[model samples]
Target: MQENKNEKPFIPTLGITIGDMNGIGPEVIIKSVMNPKIFDLVNLVVYGHGKVLSHYKNLLGVDKFSFNQTNNAGQIRYNRLNVINCVEDIEVNPGEETKEAGALALAAIQKATEDLKEGKIDAIVTAPINKNNIQSDDFKFPGHTEYFTEAFGAHESLMFLCGERIRIGVATGHISIAQIKDRLNADVIRKKLELMLKSLKKDFNIGKPKIAVLGLNPHAGEDGLLGNEEIEIIQPVINEFKEKGELVFGPYPADGFFGNSSQSKFDGILAMYHDQGLIPFKTLAFEEGVNFTAGLSAVRTSPDHGTAYNIAGKGIANEQSMRSAIYMAKDVLLARRENTH
Candidate 1:
């Protein structure tokens, strides 16, 4: 956090919504922006309860953290971290569930989403929110993607788990295991793969990306002996993409794809289900991995981990994931602007 002598706002504002208050959201964020190098890349607005963030500033030794409220929505003053605080009647207890924390987190997200739609910010990168605490009957979304889809009324969006070594995009995310077979249609897979490739090219800046498709069963259905998902569901979709000259291959077994012997075959991977992609991804790259939502009008990324409530307010929490998320958002925004020009 740096002062501009007289102080002024920075461009390409990065809107960061604090996740669950009972977790490490504020802790990691405090540690992240304390470096001041962050101000050089993007001006960050910490969307959270002002008190919680103030507590964090003291804990992290950032004596200069300050926020000046603005009358105009776009008229944000960036001194260190601009906080649009939403006060709620919640106790910030570490490793506990409470409605106050939940409501606070939701308000920040909604505000940031509106700002993104209005073009006030170039992108939004979120920290993890507690599902059990925040989810209610009215809040029907399983995660941010569902909520964003419903917000934008978009027909489809893709969830891609990104890592330095590999990236995995799901054909369908957050659905039942049994429903996956029914959902694995050629049109759906083709659409997801298309978005994945486009993301690789435009966001990731890889011109000719190679993507490997993972199978839905053991031994890749063992040529239809163990299961037919490979033959009946996956292969047809993959073959169609290959015929169109995309560098797509597989219906390969998930086990062998991430194996030490076979991990180098592709630049990215298309997984059939949740655990099929996430297990290997987290195993290899959880510390620095990022989650990006594809097909959104604006860029939204997050650290691929949840708020560690048990470690909230502790100075020892890791900032690697949050740091990676910020860098990823900047990278994507720059690439998108370049491509558009």
Candidate 2:
């Protein structure tokens, strides 16, 4: 589709993937789009089966909303919900893990990602997917962060979690705890810090972003008493960047950083591993957190939580995180465009 310059201001179209059908993906997607105001902000194209969405609509007792089925992005109507059906004859059994559910989830992600790459969609907001069941020959990445990093051919990507007051990014993610120590190095640390700094400037429109780096061990290695990673690895990188006039600080102990409210002093925080960052992030912003993959050629965001299998068809899933993911994707896209122009 070609851009029409004479029309009203261009609104980017966001493609949403239906995560594992047996999970809460469809429920949250339906609940999120029910708000008419969301339609005004961006055009939405849902890549999933129409029947699955209809099932959730009926189950949730939401009768007022309807979807317009279309196979092409150019045919999407900005004023109504648009769906591009990617699966059929699928059974949706809530709280159950099945091959069919995983296959359906993979199909939606592949299709939506293709559209995102082709510029048919401006950005993508994915619902949650179960990492175990959603594995396939075609979908072999550990999680969305790894999947998108390869999909967009990005040299590297940062798994950033953002909320109202806190922003945290992990240096290493979706890996075993034992592997974290081996993974901590000066080069990896430098790249993560660079990604976080650039993202804070371009994606979030923050100027001169101040970043805090957390240590790998207790009391920041207790000055080499607990571990030497802080002294041998982390501090050297921080010092290198600091001398270059970047607003970077720390190698602070993770416990005292969050306990003393030191996180409030920086624009972003970089943790050495997954649990070190997410444990405190979810504690503070579980409901409204957004998972954004920074350094990708195209923008992608997902809710900070996973597929809630236990609450899958209960119609009680909170849609706040899903909604925040959509809004964050839009904000990042807009910020990138503004920075480019």
Please report how far candidate 2 places residue 259 from its true position, in Å. 0.6
lDDT: worst 10-residue window of model 2? 1-10
Alpha-carbon lDDT, every model: 0.80, 0.92
lDDT, model 2, position 75:
79
Which model scores highest in lDDT?
2
Q: How accurate locally is residue 112 in candidate 2, as Cα lDDT from 0 to 100?
A: 93
lDDT tens digits by residue: candidate 2, 40-117: 888999988888888888778888879999998767988788999887668878899999888888989999998888
Best by TM-score: 2
lDDT for 229 (candidate 1): 77
- The TM-scores of all predictions, comma-separated, are 0.91, 0.97
Candidate 1 lDDT (Cα, whole model)? 0.80
Q: Where in model 1 is the C-alpha error above 4 Å?
A: 1-11, 59-73, 88-90
State how far residue 2 of model 2 sits from its true place (Å).
Answer: 26
> What's the lDDT for residue 30 in model 1?
78
